[model samples]
Target: MWVSSSAFEALLDSGACACPVRLGQRLDPSGEYVRRYVPELARVPGDYIYEPWKAPIEVQERANCIIGRDYPAPVVNHLAAAQRNRNAMKELREMLQKAPPHCCPSSDDEIRQFMWLSEEGQATATVGSN
Candidate 1:
């Protein structure tokens, strides 16, 4: 459940954790998955199904799924959250790069300690004793 800083950075850079709307558009281009699972969107056209909030009022009326009343708008702004995560990861990478070579954890216990420090918002903390 944990990954090295480089691996985590690669994941973020790869957009593997993109928001559900992007994932759905990529994996289910035809919106079949959404239509099958979400009855409210079953009648929505492929263009509007994935991101119903962007659908115009006419489209919503035609689809019979109101953004707020029937389907509900997205609660979180995925783009903002992703940007914040990227910023945090960038800071962590900078901290790791500035750390002394001896501060790099080489063992499982050391790695765990390093991770604990990171989770505690102490990415600047020394990882291993010199």
Candidate 2:
């Protein structure tokens, strides 16, 4: 429960989840929380709030905020972070498989053959297929 809540909170804080303020896309297109924390983008229009980097010169002038000048660019690229995390997880999975069986807790009912990758690309396991 703690992990789930923390993950949910992370998504919310990162603006990766849909905003409850509006329907459709949950992405914080309006940059409500972002603008609140990042005051440099407070005057940015709704269209470019989430992505101030895309704002044009005129828009920047009108808003009186310059990207990289008034506010620093986004510290982390979500796409790159996601790819890195995926690679790390894959490595961990490989390491787990190579570790000695005695290192992990054992279970009865043929636990060794309980897991398999499904055709749809899901990492799945079956306790009892029936």
Candidate 3:
């Protein structure tokens, strides 16, 4: 399969990670990029936000025409970005762990079924869109 991540995975496995990164969109230098695209991620529920700088250097190198002096270097380290996500999830886990386990909020099986059907419907719609 054609996939880009395995290379990085190997690097990581070998411990050559001079700086690991998290992935996220941020307010581009002009702020227009963020203003236009940040809203798209709003649908992704959770306070944990991805920080763009966290993306690995290989990602940075690939920016080509995308990021330059015109663009701001990632404001924070990807390691930091990862930590932020971890902290948010950790907080969530702590909250859940401390609570009574009686919450049947939603059945995982049901959610999976609904997701499958929704994906199928979406695929059909996509096919029909042409």
Candidate 4:
């Protein structure tokens, strides 16, 4: 419940996951979490271990974790994707705000059902209908 709520909040706020390295740095400054869970990054220097893709080719070689070969490069650029999602969410929020009250959920139960239907890719035309 907590995790789901947090993720939903993050999506509403930034349309992106909190930066893993930043969170890790706050929780475990030594990068212990990455070293333990991501063996490919075990030998990377603490400065670059959290964001291995930022590490230079020489550093990657030394760490024995080539960004594209050892560990796949990111398929989507996170920053760009986040910005795109944020814009789309902003537009959605604007559209929703412009909609009539009857088109919006007015109760917690209705809100939950609406969100569930949205997640399931189902039509939500009846969400707040009388």
| Alpha-carbon local distance difference test for all models | 0.74, 0.59, 0.41, 0.70
Identify the leading candidate in terms of lDDT. Answer: 1
Expressed as tens digits, the lDDT of each residue in 1-130 for candidate 4 is 3321222233344434455557788898888878999888899898887678999999999999999999878778767865676677677756866876534466656765757756434334455444
Error of 2 at 11 (Å): 18
How much does each candidate deviate from the true structure in C-alpha RMSD?
A: 9.0, 11.3, 15.5, 8.4
lDDT of 2 by residue, 1-130 (tens): 3221223222332323222334312566567777788788789888777667778989988988888888777777756765665566566556866876433214433343344344432323333334
Query: 2 or 3: which has the higher TM-score?
Result: 2
As for candidate 4, its clashing pairs are: none
* Residue-wise C-alpha lDDT for candidate 3, range 4-112, written one tens digit per residue: 1122222332222233212222333333444356653232222222443444455544543123342455666656765665566556656866877643326444554
TM-score of each: 0.62, 0.51, 0.28, 0.62
- Candidate 4 lDDT score at position 5: 23
Better of 3 and 4 by lDDT: 4
Clashes of each: 0, 1, 3, 0
Q: Which ten residues in a row have the lowest lDDT in candidate 2?
A: 1-10
Worst 10 residues of 3 by lDDT: 1-10
The list of candidate 2 runs beyond 4 A from truth reads 1-29, 100-130
Candidate 1 lowest-lDDT run of ten: 1-10
Off by over 4 Å in 3: 1-68, 102-130
